[model samples]
Target chain A: MNGDDRWDDDARAAYQLPIEGEEQARDRAILRLRRESAKRRTGMGAWWVDPDGLRMRPALAAVCVLAVLVIGAWSGAGWMASRGVRAPRPSIATLPSGSTAVTFVFRAPGATRVSLVGDFNGWDPEATPLARATTGEIWIAQVPLEHGLHAYAFVIDGRDWAPDPSAPLAPVATFGRRNSLLVVGEDQAL
Target chain B: MRRLLALALASSLLAPGRASGDESEEARLRARLKPELATPVIEVVRSAAAQGLPTAPLVARALEGASRQAGDEAILEAVRGYAAGLAAARRALGSTARAAELDAGAGALMAGVPEDSLASLKRARPSGSLVIPLVVLSDFVARGVPVANASNAVLAATRAGAADPALLRMRERIDERILRGEAPTGASREGLRELLMKTPGTPKERGSREPRERRQP
Candidate 1:
């Protein structure tokens, strides 16, 4: 046995040597690699569309719920606008105790004067006057009113009594003239 | 010493701080109205205030009359009548009724709704605010629905647990129907039917009650 022949024999023995479960170990390694590859593919791409069905992490679920709520609210607001329903402006602000500052707006073009008269101001036309906007016919006034129901009307030019077109009409036409009704607080009747 | 005590009493009575709400309200009336008119109106308001009824509405009524250029007699009559209405409303709505509720109830009473109907309404919604229901009832009457029909509709709706927004929506729908040429009574009935149908937990049969035709106003 020369050195070449001995080397050849040692190589063959090394290649053929198997202690136990060699085939099973090789098969398990192959299976693990396949699973790892599958996991890598699924985890990196759109896991939402996984054939196994929908599954989501906690963060993802929260985001999806938030998106749904925002979209629903947006669509509802659009629907309301389309129906000519104007959301009441958040114009009422807390002022001094027992009173809230409420903004009243009316449009009167070519008017010399406009005044707000209601139970809050003793129905005196001179109590709270609305200022005219420079660009348009809009007249605006912020009046501090006690929390309750009030009957009011606009005095255009200080003589013509006009009920607020946006507000509910009072039931009785006192003095044969209709007045508008306003509810100042959370318990608004109309 | 007697003279000094008399002077002290006079000064105290004349002090601005000593002027009570009733006196100030009288001052406002006197300022805005003729002295002759203010005296009687103030009496009515003071009497009402003493009876635990709201006086603001009475004073407001008188002032509104004056602002509208109404006659002194008309103003006096309006104030007296309003005070009477407030008393009646307080009776019907119970003593615990809020001021806004009383005001709305008085309007409903003045709109031809019977006192018993007002009582029935308070009975129907014992815990909730009756302002919207009472206002709606008055609105219906003002729009030409017979008082009986209006009262029945509102009572039924309130008893059925219709919220304020629902009642207001019903009012808008009825107003639209009236503007479209439907009789007020018919519009109100149909509006109530629609409301009952939509209100949660409302019985099915309650919305299908027989309708009575009322004379068109």
Candidate 2:
């Protein structure tokens, strides 16, 4: 209120700001840093680690890999087994001469009736009606013969001449057809 | 002891002949063998004949040498037995019913196997309507189908049309002719292949810049 020069230095110093506590300023600066860090941490949400979580993640991944490998191996093995294993194809059975039983098996699903036709009965289809076996699909017959190699075919449905499904096939003169060849060894029975 | 000494004396006397190799001895044995060997030879002949195979030459050769050889009765008899077995086999298989039955069954039996495998099988098991079944199977396998499918397809085709039976008959005839040493002509072969291929009706013409025969893709 006096506005005089007597306390000019004191007035100027009073008008100027005083230095604050260093500890307090440091505390304020630290508080601001912590707030910023909290905001950043909140932005990157918490990924808390459970007691067994670390072990479980790797264990699950390993189990998944193992399962895939096992499935793949099983599939591969099954495929190989299916491809490798096969049935025994039908073939001629030989027996000693004058011994009773000769059998033939031929597969012809489309044919209604199948008969054996060859030289023994002068190639008569009607004379040799082959019996069907337990499988019912195959045309089988047992007829006694003297002992020799014979040429033959399946007379299907009384009309069509078809070769045996299990016979040794030969390319014949007729397009799309084959003949069966059989050899009966003497004294070498089935 | 006396018999043993006699046998020694005989062997010593024959030692000079023993100096010869197997071929000479075989020949000498052939020359001195007897008729007792006929049984086996007949057996062999029967077996071969059963499949309508000609074992005559084999039997004749065996007998020719063995019968002349008064050397070993066993040799002659062995040869005859071989012939007999072959003959018996042939006779057994020669029956029309048996052969037909064998052939049809074989088509199915050889399914899913390769030709080489079947060939091995043939070697191992020398009986039945084998060669023909194997041939069909082999052809099918070569054409990319499993043996089962090939066999089934063939059976189906064989059952299919007006010409099916005729074709089957022709196959038998052709086989017989071949066995008798006749050479098959191209047209006949083509016809047969066509039948086997079962390409219903005439082969269709593929669109042609090149003729179908010349086209390779």
Candidate 3:
């Protein structure tokens, strides 16, 4: 009984030492692999190529903000155009020499063309063509006018005569149609 | 030969200097008008200019006719009528009247307002520009206000010390009232009443409110 028991114990001990050494070697190899993987993740290889690495640099942030604003403005203008809203009131800026810069805005949604025909422009429809705005319904023309009374009308598509709905009607209907009246006072908007 | 030379010298002496503005205006007329129609129209404009009246209205009238596809005769008549109106306006508004006043005055006259009303307006607003009062007067007439009623309303407003803004406001109110289905005359009368009430220093008593002539400067 003593001999058999002693031999079994010695054999078990001899096997346990190699097993423990193998496990230690395996653990060290595993740790080396983990450290190499971590180095690759944080290294220059990932820094330049990874999108997350760009995280809000000033140039990129500014570009993003500008892109958002441009998209917003474009959409807003398109919405305004679809609604057929009237353009804003005519703007008048007085020059240093007391001359007036009169911005004439007309809303003609479906018209292909619009022109300003007035006494100041010799009543020639082609003399002052109004430009269509991005809003699509409005046509605008700027005129430098002297300080006096001006009689004007809008010619639409070169055939239809339209008076300014915003201005006073002229007292006389010389051509069997009433024109609009504008009186430019000193430093005054139409 | 001596007689011919003398006649040529006399002709040269008598010819008026053609201003660059006049040339440009003539060129515009020619360019805008047909060949046969241009000559008579130019003569009318020149005559009006020679008389110290504003020729722009005359030229504008001709061009308006052309733009409207009016007949040549109609165009000529329009220009001549406008020129006559300008002359009448000058006489009524006096030589001191500015180009704007004359233009407005001409428009008022063409709208069936009596020349005397223009004269009265000049007297009422002697120091101020009469453009607004005249334009408002013309607008009232155009809106179907009887010429006399429009004249009286504007005259009263002017004599009540209403400035251009006040007069414009009165016009806007009248227009709104007319748009709301009120009779033009009643609208004008009520509009005038509202203005008089709002006017500073205007007597509240119906009897105390003097006639326009009595209040004139």
Query: Candidate 3 chain B: minimum summed lDDT over ten consecutive residues — where?
Result: B207-216
Question: Which residue pairs clash within candidate 1?
Answer: none
lDDT of 1 by residue, B130-197 (tens): 88888778778877887888888888888888988898888889878987899988898899999999
Q: After superposition, how far is residue A164 of candidate 3 from its true place, in Å?
A: 1.1
User: Mind giving the per-residue lDDT tens digits that candidate 1 earns over A1-190?
Assistant: 8999999999999988985898899999999999976775677555566665456799999999999999999787555433322123467676669677777777676788999898888888999998886635667788777778888888999999887665666778879887877676745424
RMSD of 2: 22.1
DockQ of each: 0.39, 0.02, 0.45
Question: How are the candidates ranked when ordered by TM-score, highest leading?
Answer: 3, 1, 2
Sorted on DockQ, best first, the list reads 3, 1, 2
Which tens-of-lDDT digit does each residue in A104-165 have in candidate 3?
77778789999999988888899999999877778888887777898988888999998776
Q: What local lDDT does model 3 show for residue B101?
A: 85
lDDT of 3 at B11: 72
Worst 10 residues of 1 chain A by lDDT: A80-89
lDDT of 3 by residue, B1-217 (tens): 9999999998777664457668877998899899999999999988988998888778788888988899999999988988888889999999999988888998899888889888988888888889889888988998899888899899989988888888888998998798889999889888888888888988765323544543332
